[model samples]
Target: MTSPSELPSTPAPTTEFEIFRGLHYRDQPLVLPNAWDFASAALLATEGFPAIGTTSLGVAAAAGLADGAGVTETETLAMARRLAGLPVPVTVDIEGGFHEIPSAVADFVKQLAACGIVGVNLEDGRAGSALAAPDHQAELITAIKNRTPEVFVNARVDTYWLSLDHSSTHDRVRRYAAAGADGIFVPGLTDRTGIEQIVAATDLPVNVLYSATGPTVATLAELGVRRVSTGSLLYRAALSAAVDVARAVLQDAPVSSGIVTYPDIQRLLPAR
Candidate 1:
């Protein structure tokens, strides 16, 4: 693991972004585990995930705010600060830059760059609309990259998630890459053909959100995907497991097996 202190001094933003990009497509594609808070990020870092990411859904849900509603800017910033203190590279999901205006969004990326974050996932869900106008979102991406060239901008197009009537995922990716996006992320992309198309269409590295129905790491790598993000899956699974355990205890049913022991969790916790 590369410690923050050991990283080159005065590193260019593009340099840092390339380093993270290089982690992808290596022996194994970079499997990014998303965390909502400091402890979770630190725990994953301690467990040897070379990099950690923030989940917008988990961050918003923990604060009782609506996810993808642009309500967690401050919370995300604070979380970035906390995660930066960890030993590994930190990437944050600044959902849609928490604002529509390009300058406002660009300023937000600048703030994140100052917080020692090497990368950010900027989505184009467009608040209440299905997906932001491709041109409008591309403007935002270009503004962010021009302002903070070193920050890896993982431009996320949520056409699949929003169930939009888009015929060309390749076209969408091309627009973002022309706008200077470092990488392209297509969440809710589970089909092999679609994944392969996007991976081949763009020169930028492709990031796919991990789904139970989606291709496995080896398969995604085989198809030329560079990064696989867990997104909100881990957090959602943890919630589901908690509910299942509680229900079993109340009904006098047997607890699930493979529960991590308290001692194991203790060892995972940061030393006091």
Candidate 2:
């Protein structure tokens, strides 16, 4: 089997969208770190990430809203506007497009594209943990593409995440690909064989949610995965660190070293 690294490199990208799209067709999979807010996004950008993504769960949780409940559209858009100035391109998760109507969903994505966002993760999973009809989801993908051809539409299939009828993964991905999705994201798929099969199922880039216990980045790259996302993991880990440090303070235990200082965070903010 030929490795992506051995393949010929493509021409240089001329646009932000092209830059982001090119990240998927590289020697190694694009390891995307999901940020919940401007500070997190900025920090990741300064740390040298090629691009940044917004975790729907992280955004919803920070705003005290439930993830995938379709209640954080405003907050999500607000975050996109705030992160537009970051050095790297940004993609956001618009859970189920925040509306049942395909056009309305596309309109919301247009708002993000206007904010200079280069990509979006539109999932088929809906409120109440139900998966939308494949055709309906495809309609949503088509509408977004028609409205904003430049924005990378990462059509997400939640069959694996929701653990309902895993057999539908191939058909769903092919349907979205036919509908013009720029990529396919399967969030709970981590096993090597599963990843390989899905990557083989479509010509579009394949994105998998990063799992601590799953295949490593090098392994995923070898499996032909194109994009690996740390969805909500960073935010959750930050929360866990905060609680742990507080507990240590109460116990008079030595704090963890190498933690980011207050000044480091202050520096990440705008000068004005």
Candidate 3:
């Protein structure tokens, strides 16, 4: 795999608006693998993920902070800077902007843009509110575009996740699109009918959260989804695997001998 430094340093989309549009027409759905930190981001980039996203849950957990609480802004930005040096594009999950003011959120995005991030996921699950008022969230989205138009604004609407009325999802998506969002993310939506309705109703690309029970990738493609995100699934899976491994060791259960050799692991380390 090519080193991030070896990749061309194309200037990010000149405007956030352009970045949002560019992500939609790609030949296939953007299969984004969310990473927790530098090593994960680097390995995923090396594995040829054209774009990588930061998982807020993963980041916050690593820092011993609560996810979506606005406590990891500095940590998130630091990770973005490191990822910026990688070959593929990096889009971060900025949980609710860590602040209510749109300008504060926009300021945070400007720092990310300066670090070479091409996109970000700004969700609308307001702290404590069932959902941030559509108009209020739209204001934040518009402010971000106005401040840093080159960063792809993935405006996430968590209506379904918050157990709010599903009917409001479409209206919120439309409002986000009008607010200069490049893509719309509906994470808790899984059913075929609901997915189709959202896709049919929105002009922007619809990003769906991949669920084991939801339609398969092929089905999502057929239904017009332009992006599929794993969200915290990978992070959770890693935790589960670790716990299982620990239990096996404690119980003296036979373990697979096909693990990577120390030499192989050493090969991945940067030069001393």
Candidate 4:
């Protein structure tokens, strides 16, 4: 079994970061799938995803902590350390920076960089039913960039996500872009018109969440999106499948014919 430290503790090549950033601007959008832990990330890398994003929901839920509560900092870094050993670039979701002070967020990002993570999703969504003041979120983004200039910082605006009047959504995007964000991420924004508006408004890469009711990856690429993220969809779908399988097995129903072998994951685990 290969421990994280035993595998390697060095940052990936600088080209890895460039390759990840370049993926966003290719003719096709970078379709990023979110992974919760080592096995999930390893599986995605083995399946040939050039990069993977961490889902805060899956990280918190796996440990009985609630997402967006700022309680999983240690666990998040721990997972980052493990996933650093994978063959592809890794980006993390540090929800709301997990701290109020801008410098603290910067310091946290430094830690992630040490783990070889090349990018992060820092959102403006708040704990309460409100959005972080755009100016404040920009401050955090600036501080993180000042501290970790090498890490790709994706600034996420939650205006559309919170269902707030997005009269100033474009303004928020501009603020983040000015603050040195490497990309712009807008979750819950699916309208082709609105997406095009945002895309034309900034030179930074535009990232949108994938929606079942909205544009597919190819459609998003046509609309000028640079990246398409699955967000928590993979994690949620994994949870659903586990529950459904458990119900079937407990109810004496015939189980599915096969399951993917997890021996490689076992090999990667340390023997007690």
Instruction: Give TM-scores for every candidate, taking all chains together and pairing residue i with residue i.
Output: 0.88, 0.95, 0.88, 0.91
lDDT string, candidate 4, 184-221, tens digits: 99999999999999999999999999999998888898
In model 2, the clashing pairs are: none
Instruction: Judge candidate 3 against the unseen true structure and give its global Cα lDDT, from 0 to 1.
Output: 0.86
Model 2 agreement with the true structure over 1-272: per-residue lDDT tens digits: 98999999967899999999999999999999999999999999999999999999999999999999999999999999999899999999998999999999999999999989999999999888899999999999999999999999999999999998798989999999999999999999988999999999999989999998999999998899999999999999999999999999999999999998899999999998
Ranking by lDDT: 2, 4, 1, 3
Q: What is the Cα-based lDDT of residue 19 in candidate 1? A: 69
In model 2, which range of ten residues has the least summed lDDT?
A: 6-15
lDDT of each: 0.86, 0.95, 0.86, 0.90
lDDT string, candidate 3, 1-272, tens digits: 99998999967766434554566677678788899987777767777777789899999999898887778998999888878877667899998888789999999999999988889899998666468889999999999999998888999999997888678888999999999998999998999999999999988889999999999888999999999999998888878877888889999998656654577555545675
Query: Clashes per prediction?
Result: 2, 0, 5, 0
The deviation in Å at residue 257 for candidate 1 is 5.2
Q: Write the per-residue lDDT of candidate 1 for residues 110-201, one digit (tens) a residue.
A: 98889888899999886785688889989999999889998889999888878785575677799999999989999988999988889888
Give the higher-lDDT candidate: 1 or 2.
2
Which pairs, if any, clash in model 4? none
Model 3 clash count equals 5
For candidate 4, the per-residue lDDT at 52 reads 94
Query: Comparing 1 and 3 by lDDT, which wins?
Result: 1
